[model samples]
Target: MTYLPLVNGERTYLATWMDLYSRKVVGWQVGKTMEDELVILPLRRALQWRQPVTGLIIHSDRGGQYVSAELKELL
Candidate 1:
């Protein structure tokens, strides 16, 4: 995740999911607030785009959103 400052002084967050081997961004979402949906939505997009089978592993920092029950259930 990354934060960007806008001209209006408010900040926006970008959440991304990248392919580890290719170093390419597979999915991404931008939101005004750092919420679980920011992370979860990108993961959902990545899954549809990549369509990987089982044993898929995801790595992320222990942010509250990343560890949320909603995200865990989806994973």
Candidate 2:
């Protein structure tokens, strides 16, 4: 996952999750605040839609949101 800052004058965040094997975006979410939900929502959506088997590996930068206790529990 990654956070992208939009160039729309006002600050906006775009969070995305990609499937490395396919090199395609599996899920995404846009929000005004850079909160944990920004990353978690996309991850939950991807899990619900793709339903990958166990032992799935998710690679992401060491952002605070990714390391949060809530997110760790979810994973």
Candidate 3:
């Protein structure tokens, strides 16, 4: 996740999922808070849109949100 600086030094978070094979951004979401939903929502959208076959792999840095219970259930 990354942040976009707003006025007064406040920020919003952006979460994205990319198709590794195609090098295309498949899903993204932005919000005021950097919670698990930031990442989970994008992944959910990508899965619904792509509907890839079983055994697909999702890769990410070792971010705490990625290991959340909700995200694990979705995966």
Candidate 4:
């Protein structure tokens, strides 16, 4: 996950999408923003590699980064 750097103190964000069935990482992205779409990039990449995400269950920490109006709408 993205976090503040101790030395630089920059607010960073990390986004990752994983597959529940095989317990494998599907994809990931990194940036400095926390908009709802922060998690979308990775999700899209994962989707391209697997079948439809019909039964996918996305789970993560309750950080504002994970819960956003755009993400709620987009996902």
Model 3: lowest-lDDT 10 consecutive positions: 56-65
- lDDT order of candidates, top first: 1, 3, 2, 4
In model 2, the runs with Cα more than 4 Å from the true position are 1-8
Candidate 2 similarity to native, TM-score: 0.87
Clashes of 2: 0
- lDDT tens digits, residue span 1-75, model 4: 665565676668777777777889898887777665768778777877886647667788877867777666756
Sequence-dependent TM-score of model 1: 0.95
Q: lDDT of all predictions, in order shown? A: 0.95, 0.86, 0.94, 0.73
TM-score of each: 0.95, 0.87, 0.94, 0.64
lDDT of 2 by residue, 1-75 (tens): 434656775667889999999998988999988899999999999989999999999888879989988889979
Q: Of models 2 and 4, which has the larger TM-score?
A: 2
lDDT of 1: 0.95
Which candidate tops TM-score? 1
Model 1 pairs whose backbones collide: none
Candidate 3 — what's its lDDT?
A: 0.94
TM-score of 4: 0.64
Candidate 2 residue-wise lDDT at 20: 90
For candidate 2, the 10 contiguous residues with the lowest summed lDDT are 1-10
List candidate 1 segments past 4 Å from native: none
lDDT over C-alpha atoms for residue 67 of model 3: 94
